[model samples]
Each structure stands twice: as C-alpha cells, then as structure tokens.
Target: MAFKYSGSICSDLDKIRVFIDEILDKLNSIIKDQDTMFDLKLILNELVINGVFHGNECNNNKCVRLYLEVIDNIVRIEVEDEGKGIDYDISSYNSAELKCCGRGLIIVNGLSDEFYVKKNKVIAVKRIN
Candidate 1:
C-alpha cells in the first residue's frame, strides 16, 4: 500500500519548520536513503515557504495545503495556497540572475524529477530509487 499524508497550514512562517519536520519524520519511516530524505526535505521546505509567503502573502486567513504520497518508489508532493497565483515561468529564472527573488521554483524544478505549477499550486515528483 502507498503511504499518504495530507496537512494544511496558515500563513505563519514559524509553523513551517515544525510541519516540515513532522512530515519528514513520517516520510523517513518509509524512505531509508539519507540523500533522498535530504532532497525531499529541501523540496518540501521551498514549496511550503513559497506557498505561505508568496502565494498566501503572509495572510493568516489564507491556508496552504500540503499533500505527500509514496507509491512505486516515487515520491509525489503537492502544495496549494489560497491566493491568486503566479505567472512567472521556471525556465525564465536564470541562475546568473542571482539578485532576483523568484528562484524558489527554479530550484524546485531542478531538484524534483518532475514538477509543474497549476494556478496557486505546485506539484513535484521525485523517484526514490
């Protein structure tokens, strides 16, 4: 059976760290690789922060949904925020442009085996082989 977990958070950034750790602990029980765990942690952190800060704009009224699943050795993560969403393309973020502030998606896209954005949501997939 596939392991699955779903959680929601407000716009508070402080809660993010705790949430990440909780989710990571659950994932760790199923995923034994240190490298995979580290990468997953990074991916989750970046996506959740973006959802809370950028997507929800630190508005306490808004919420961010986090979904995680492990099936067939593939880890799937989805984060959605209650906001208007963004229009920037991940491909447009050049590493050379270090001064920009929208590099989170760029890093996420690079790290995850497959990732995409839908409205105010980001979906990322990574193989844990």
Candidate 2:
C-alpha cells in the first residue's frame, strides 16, 4: 500500500502537533514499527519547527508546505517555507558544538538515511523495517 500527504499549513507552532498527528494517523498502517514511527515523529517536529521559527520567522501569514510519501518500505518527507532559502551548507553542520540551539538539522541528518536542502525546501528519506 502507498500513502501520501501534500499540503500547506500555517506557520503556527500550535498547529504543528495537530499536523503531525494527522500525518501519523495516515502512516500508522503502512509503518507498524514503533522505532520508525518515533523517528518519523521527531523528524517531522524538527523540520516543521525550523520552518516556522527560522524560515518563516514565526510569521503567521506565511505557510509551510509539506510532502510526505510512503511507498512500500521507503518514506520521503519534504518541507518548504516561504522565506529566503538556506544560506549555509547542511552537510558541513557540526552536531558536536556546545551550543544549545541549531541542532535540528543534525538530528534530522542522523536519523534520516538521506537528507538534503534545496532552495527553500528540505528533504529527508528513510527506509522502514
């Protein structure tokens, strides 16, 4: 079976949880593994939070576009924001820094099988068991 979700959500922090729950509901049947689901949830949270805080600068007027697709054992996630594109290199991000902030991309990169940023969109791919 295949599942997909392509939609836009307001850049409101309060709506992120509801959006994630809806996505999880859609993915429950296709992804039965608890660990995978947990990882996906974390990934979604990080990406959406980044889009709201960094990309959109917490602007409620802007919207974040999300694309989620699960085909067989592979799952793909994409998030796009309305603000300017990324300025730095994502691959060179240092997760070991002693800072308290800016670890979202690092966490997403570690959990995802493949992660990349293009323009205003960030994409992550994971293989489920």
Candidate 3:
C-alpha cells in the first residue's frame, strides 16, 4: 500500500512547517527511526521553506505545492512552486564560498540522502523500512 500527502502554504514559513509536520506525523508509523525521521523532516522543511522564501520571495499570496509519496519503502518528496523559478545555478558557485543567506538549502543538502532540483521544484528522497 502507498500514500500521498500534499498541501499548499500561504507563503508563510510557519504555516509551511506545520504543513510538513502534519505529513511526518501521518507517516510516523513507517518513519519510526529518529535519525531518519529527523533527516526527512529537516530536508523537507528546508526545501519547502526555500521554495517559499527565495523561490517565491515570501509572497504571502503566492502558494507552493508539496507532494510526498511512499513507494517501495522510499519516501519521495517533491516541493513545487509557481514563483519566479530557481534562477541561480549552484554548479557555478565557488566551492569555497557556496552558502545562502538563511542556510536553508545547505542544511537540506546535508541531510537528504539524495536530492535534486529542476526549475522551482526541489525533490528530497529517503529510504526506510
């Protein structure tokens, strides 16, 4: 069996965090490992917050879509937004000074087992049993 979790945030960071916490709570049965749970939570939070903050530039009226799917014991999360879209290319940034103002994506990249970005959507994935 599989499940899908999705929601839209009012361009508000707190609301977005709550939106994610709700999904994590629902998936608690499968995500019992604290470390795995923390990683998933933090990664999703950071990416979603980034999409809402930098991608959409904190436009409260604008909405961001978050989708989480469980398949083959892998929790795949895709956060989508209709903002200006990711303008920068992390690949071009210098390795020595690669950092963001809020350090949101940095935390996400560090925690996620695997993650990637396409346009304005950032995908975070984790495998759990």
Candidate 4:
C-alpha cells in the first residue's frame, strides 16, 4: 500500500513552513535516510513557497494544496495554488548564477529525480533507499 498525506493551507508565509514541517514529520516514519530527508525538506520548501507567494500572491483567501505520496523507495510531491499559473521555463535560468530569489525551481529541478509543472501545480519526485 502507498502512504499518502495531503492538505491545503491559506497563502500565509508564516504558516506554510509549519504545514510542510508537519507533513515531513509524518513522512519521516516511512523514509529512512539522512540525505533524503534533507533533500526532501528543501524540495518541499521551494515548491510550497512558490505556491504560496508566487502563485497565490500572498492572498490569504487563496489556498495552496500540498500532497505527498510514498511507495517503496519512490516519493512524489505535488503543490498546487488557487491562482493563474505562470509561463514557467526552468531551462532559461542558469543554475550556477547567484541570486537571492527565483532559484527555487532551479534547485528543485536539480535535486528531484523527476520534476514537472502543470498550470499552477508543481510536482517533483525523489527516490530514497
């Protein structure tokens, strides 16, 4: 059986991290690897932040959906926002370039085994053995 967890939260910056942490806390029981835990935390943070700030524009009324699923060693994460999606093209940004912001997608793409965007939703997968 696959382990799954999902919830939606308002576009509140302060609350997003807490919600992600709660989900990760539950995932920890299933995933057992120090490196995998760290990578998953980073990936989840990047995606959720984008969903709340960029996608919903910090509008409290709008919500961001967070979803996670783990099957064996493979883990899939999905974040969707209640807003119009942007024209996301990860290929345009050079990963090496230094920037304070707008690097989340770049980071996610590099770390995840698979990454894709559909409308206002971003999905990433990583394998933890």
Candidate 5:
C-alpha cells in the first residue's frame, strides 16, 4: 500500500516540527510497532528540519513533502522540498552525543536500512524484519 503526506508551510522552524509530527502520526498507524515508528519519526523530523532550515534557508514561502510506501515487506519514506539540495558528508557526522543535530542526516543513515538522496529530496527505507 502507498500513503502520502505533504505540507506547504512557512519556513518557520516551529512549523517544521508540526508538519513532521503530523506526517509521522499518519504513517505510524500502518507500521508494525512503536520502535519502527519512532525511528521513522526521528528520521522524518530531521529531514524536514534540514529541508527548511538549511536547504530552503528558512524561506517561509517554500514547502516540503513526505511520501510513505510499503512494498515487499519494506517501508519507504521520501522527503522532498522546494529548496535546493544540500551537500553534506553523511559519513563524517558524530553518531553519539546529546546534541546530534549537527549529524542529523548521519543519524538517519544509521537508523535506516537503506538511504538515498537526490537533488531536492531524500529517501529512507527500513525492511520490516
């Protein structure tokens, strides 16, 4: 099955949290457990925040979209934004720390079974094992 969630909001950081929480809730219902949901939730939140704060440069006029898909026993999450893509080293981020926001994408890479990115977008995948 395929489910889609999207938001076009001001680039305000607060709005980023709200929209991500909203999308995470909708996807959690279809997932297997709380752990999975939480993982996906964290990854989703990070991507959304990155898209707004860093990618779009806090342009309130821009928006982002998140797409969820379940296929072949795997869950896929895609985040797309209206802003230009960011070029960061996903590998060199600090993995363990109280403040890991600097390595949000790296943390996401560790949590996801598979991760991919494209211009203006990112995708996180987890196999429901």
Candidate 6:
C-alpha cells in the first residue's frame, strides 16, 4: 500500500501543529510503530519550523510546501519554503553540546536515515520496519 500527501500551508508556526496532525492521521494506518511515529513527528516539526522561521522569515504571506509519501515501508518527506535558500555547511553543526539554536537541522539529520537539502527544500527519508 502507498500513502501520499502533497500540500501547501501558510508559513505560520501556529499552523504546524494542525498540519502535522493531519499528516499523522493519514499515515496512522501505515505506520504503527511508536518509535517511528515519534521520529516522524520530530522530523516534521523541525523541518517545518525551519522552513517557516529561517526560510520564510515567519511571513504568513509566504507558503511552505510539504510532500509526504510512504511506499514499501519507506517514508519520504519533503519541505519547501518561499525563500532564497540555505547556504551553510550542515556538517559543522555536528556537536553533542546542547544549544538554543542551530540544532534543528542536526536533530533532523540524526533522526532521518537519509537527509539532504536542495535549494529551499529539505528532504528526508526513513525506513519503517
């Protein structure tokens, strides 16, 4: 079976919760493992938050596009924002120390089996057993 969701949402932090809930609801039947669900939630939150805050600069007029797909026990997540793009070394944030900022990408990278950034879009993949 395959489940997919491709949609766009306003770049507002307040809308993230509802958007995530809707995605989770759609995937509930496919993903039953609690750990995988938690990881997915975290990944979704981090990516969306980053897109809204850093990419779109919290501008509600802008929109964040999201694409989620699950097929053959593999989950693919993509988030795109309406900003220029990111230009930084992702590996530089690989530290165990806890900081207030600059941890979202690290957390997302650690949790995801595959993670990458292309222009204004972030993509992550996870294998659900």
* Cα TM-score of candidate 5: 0.78
What lDDT tens digits, residue by residue, belong to model 1 across residues 1-129?
379989898888788788889999988888898999999998999999988888889898988999999997999999999989887686677678694468878878888999989889899999996
Better of 1 and 4 by TM-score: 1
TM-score of each: 0.94, 0.92, 0.83, 0.91, 0.78, 0.92
Please identify which of the two predictions, 2 or 3, would achieve the higher lDDT against the true structure. Answer: 2
Flag regions of model 6 displaced more than 4 Å. Answer: 94-99
After superposing all C-alphas onto the true structure, candidate 1 shows an RMSD in angstroms of 1.2
Off by over 4 Å in 4: 95-101
Worst 10 residues of 2 by lDDT: 93-102
Better of 1 and 5 by TM-score: 1
Question: What is the per-residue lDDT of model 6 for residues 1-129, given as tens digits with 9 covering 90 to 100?
Answer: 698899999987667889888898778777899899999999999999899999999999999999999998899999999999886567677467666466888888889999999889999999996
Cand. 2 TM to true fold: 0.92
- Candidate 4 differs from the real structure by a C-alpha RMSD in angstroms, to one decimal, of 1.6
Please, what's the RMSD in Å of model 3? 2.3
> Considering every candidate listed, which one attains the maximal TM-score?
1
lDDT by residue (tens digit), candidate 5, 65-112? 767777766788788888777665666565565555557777788899
Instruction: In candidate 6, list every pair of residues with a backbone clash.
Output: none
CA error at residue 106 for candidate 1, angstroms: 1.1
Note the clash tally of each candidate.
Answer: 0, 0, 0, 0, 1, 0
**How well is each residue in 24-64 modelled by candidate 3, as lDDT tens digits?**
88887766778888788777777777777777888998888
State how far residue 34 of model 5 sits from its true place (Å): 1.2
Candidate 5 clash pair list: 11-60
Per-residue accuracy of model 4 over 5-75 as CA lDDT, tens digit each: 88899988888878988988987887779899999999999998888888898899999998899987889
